[model samples]
Target: MTEMVKGYNFAFIDEYAKREIRRKVLKAVSIPGYQVPFGSRELPIARGWGTGGLQITLSLIGQKDILKIIDQGSDDSVNAVNIKRFIEATTGVFITSDTLKATIIQTRHRIPEEELGDDQILVLQVPYPEPLRIVEPEEKETRRMHAEMDYAKIWVFLYENIVKWKEITIGARYPVMVAGRYIMDPSPIPRYDVPRLNNARTLYLFGAGREKRIYAVPPFTEVKPLEFEDHRFRIENFKGKACELCASTDTFLDEIILDDKRMYTCSDTSFCKKRGNNPRVLKYIDRNQQ
Candidate 1:
């Protein structure tokens, strides 16, 4: 562990930066799907990693906030652990792995298996904030398309995918219509977590530091994944597979290979541990699904 320099502001980011970020966050929340540009300051971490999410977490976190950070749904992952420790050391905020206990969760690639309450806020680390980037690389053109609400290219791309694969081959970073207005990418979260974003009770804030963009999904707002009437959006099916540890069929499972033997386990380590110890946790997952 590196020794901290004496008399630094909380979370390592200066007060001015935090204030500016908060302002941008407010603007993002007001617009829902509109991406708000910000002056992204360089952090100790390099760009394209988690600098975006880290900045957001550091800005919003307070001494009283109970923070939880996870990568691919595991609290023990290297990125998660480092971010959690950094935040704790800087802000002196309490940290926990329990989803229900956390007031704020900063995640990469996954959302927790447990349902988040209205009081909780989810800060997602986004590598690419633009849904139209693949179709239109030019920022000015994409902005013009967004201004005119033109998504023909996006629709065409989806249609072509269906024509070739017979199904939407996109497994992650699924494009969605936010509040039936702007098209937004919900980061690279698995398709399983897409439904959780629909009219979610908790607020969702997306940050892309490398891109210097911030977007949000306010609580109870509409978020529909792009799909056609005949070709509806589908989640990743486990094909009757369940977690070997907790026997959870609904939660996302990670496959591990050991000595050529394949094993399945829950990706959300905390949820799996709780479920393994207490059978009643199944009810929570069921209720959340409803």
Candidate 2:
């Protein structure tokens, strides 16, 4: 067991791989929203299953950094638990379910409901980094289009969506124009979380292992979702629904079906737990009463 453990570095990845990733991360940060290419190493995990986010986490993590891993807003999910355990075993870093206590957060699908501070960093797992992939399959052509800021095709696609669906049919992975310069996918985060990425206090990094790309949204960067002037960008509307457990209306809720009875609960478990014990719940209740 001791000999097997000695075969791998602190994060199971070698120091050279970490340094290369760090260098690419710096470049990604320097030019926010620009997808920097890197040599993605094969981990014990499979690709298309969060190898990108895992690589990023393993590279940037330190002994002092408090890491939090979440999948679809739940830390207790299978993917989250596995990644958390892997990181803990390798780096010996303190792991936390509390969003506020986490220095580094690796998330898939959902962003935390609570506001992230400037000190925090969010690493998103991206299956695809290119927003124009649906429009153009060839990567070289897409790169050219991005270089010339030729998003006319994308705009036309959005226009078509309005004409066909009466609303932007993109449920998630909505494309956004980042920093008024480059167009980005913002990963697979829901449209509700897209607004949170705009001018965010925390640094938002995205990694796509299969795609071999890394992108970033630095603090205070602009991130405008693609939409026509007539058809503005919108988020998922719960239609007057509130979490059954927390009784909070101002949070993203997951619909729960128990015994054919539909109910809503906060998608973010840590945020829900915190808000349940917080006095702010009283304020929310009082405001509703008035």
Candidate 3:
């Protein structure tokens, strides 16, 4: 039993290690947009498998806290489900699919539909935290560029691309200027999640395990998605369609391709999977007749 116990619970990270992570988190919260480097631990989970998010969750989870997790906006997505199970197994904390019930949420790729309040905290798993990563491959160079707010190269690159392609030609993981100081990666969240970050009520934290960086956006921070005055900001969507399963018009819809029959249905799979029977999802449907 002693030998078996050696490989489990908190993995290889000692209590001191966790305390170090807690210290970095505190610094991240105190100085918004400033990157705090921490000694990241090797979890049982592999790198880029939401390891950063899991570390933040482990460090901050108090005895009484409800946790919610989502990947690409779906609770049951394999990565999200696995991470949720792992955290629950380690902490014995209750996990909820409902966004509102959660005090702490760790997410990848998408933000939830519900508006977050100041009481909640959102943790983002960032594959790459450096916004200047494309322009300067070396971490050392990017850090210098950020310190000087030298983004002339990024703007020139974008301008050249538009000149050649007749459009910006970039989608998802778009760069943004945070607090008009640091140019930050808003993780890989869809463009829809970009606007939601602007002056949001919730505290937002980003962690990159591979890079050993942690950062934050305090409540009411100015997060501007990279854009032009004439171009404005927008999110992609299927026009004039509602979810077939939940019939939600306002929710983000996933296009489901039905086999090779050339037929498709608009469905908000997350909503359908969560609350199909709830009144909010089924209000317009005649369930009794069915």
Candidate 4:
């Protein structure tokens, strides 16, 4: 933690609200990819500004928990810095930019490039929680579709994308089938990060404050992106380009233009720093050494 504040509870929320949120989180974990409704409480921050994830983190955090907050894979960004300050002030818990040291990581928009272990919990900030909403507008109709496991319309949506663009045009928020059951919107994570969700060690918790929804993906769960036989799902390819700073070819690279020249860099800042400092990481696998 940066520094502890005198006023406020250990985790900033009352005991009653914490218990309720915990119960809802358990239900979401029991049924993977199933959206569980909860009573979203008003926080100090605005509703659409990461309140859902902040709420979940507040509910789950303990004294021993080392938290990490990131926005779009950066630690020093405006959103990340503000959220980190809020969390450390309220909880007084240890905060780290090092991905491996964090027991609970609250993130928006992007998952860390380093693989998370079973001991870690990743709390993702979701703007929208419903995957079926793309095809069905009403809440009742979407609930019915989930209950019956009817996903023909969403399938048609994908099929139509392939028909027109010759590929899946979804840039982010890729719809994935969780545990071969419910189709979930993986919270705007890119296609590159989609593959990391399948049978991973980390437990993923998604919170949508505005939507009053919470969902989870437990350890070793099967998460598959929607794809066909011929037109298979693919991640963004850099065409042999590597990160300009880290020289990492295997990890995801962000395209940048410096002085009218194309440059590629690692979106995960910690990953870039780790590789840039270590000479033995030539294998290019973005894993935490510690």
Q: Candidate 1 versus the native: TM-score?
A: 0.95
Candidate 4 local lDDT, 40-138, one digit each (tens):
998877887888898999999999999999988889889899988888888878889988889999998888988788899999999989998878889
For candidate 4, the TM-score is 0.94
Question: After best superposition, candidate 2 residue 192: deviation in angstroms?
Answer: 0.6
Q: RMSD for each model, in Å, please?
A: 2.3, 4.0, 5.5, 2.3
Across 154-246, the per-residue lDDT of candidate 2 in tens digits comes to 888888988998987788999998888899988888888999998888999999999999999999999899887888999989988988888
Name the candidate that leads on TM-score.
1
Candidate 1 residue-wise lDDT, 1-290, digit = tens? 33444676888999999999999999999998999999998887779878888899889988899999999989999988877767776777788999999999999999898988889999999999999998999999998998899999999999999999899878899999999999999999998899889988899999999999999999999999999999999988888888899988878999999897888999999999999998577524365466
Clashes of each: 0, 0, 0, 3
Instruction: Give the per-residue Cα lDDT of candidate 4 at 135.
Output: 84
Best-to-worst order by TM-score is: 1, 4, 2, 3
Q: Tell me which residue pairs clash in candidate 3.
A: none
Please, what are the lDDT tens digits per residue for candidate 3 over residues 1-290? Answer: 01223345553356787889989988987877778888988887889988887788888886689998988877878998888777776666778877778999999887777777789999999898887887789978888887788888888777776679766656778887778777778888877678788888889999999888999988998888777666655686656776666555666666666766332232324455555566364412244765
Error of 4 at 207 (Å): 0.7
- Candidate 4 to native Cα RMSD, angstroms: 2.3
Candidate of highest lDDT: 1
lDDT of each: 0.90, 0.88, 0.77, 0.89
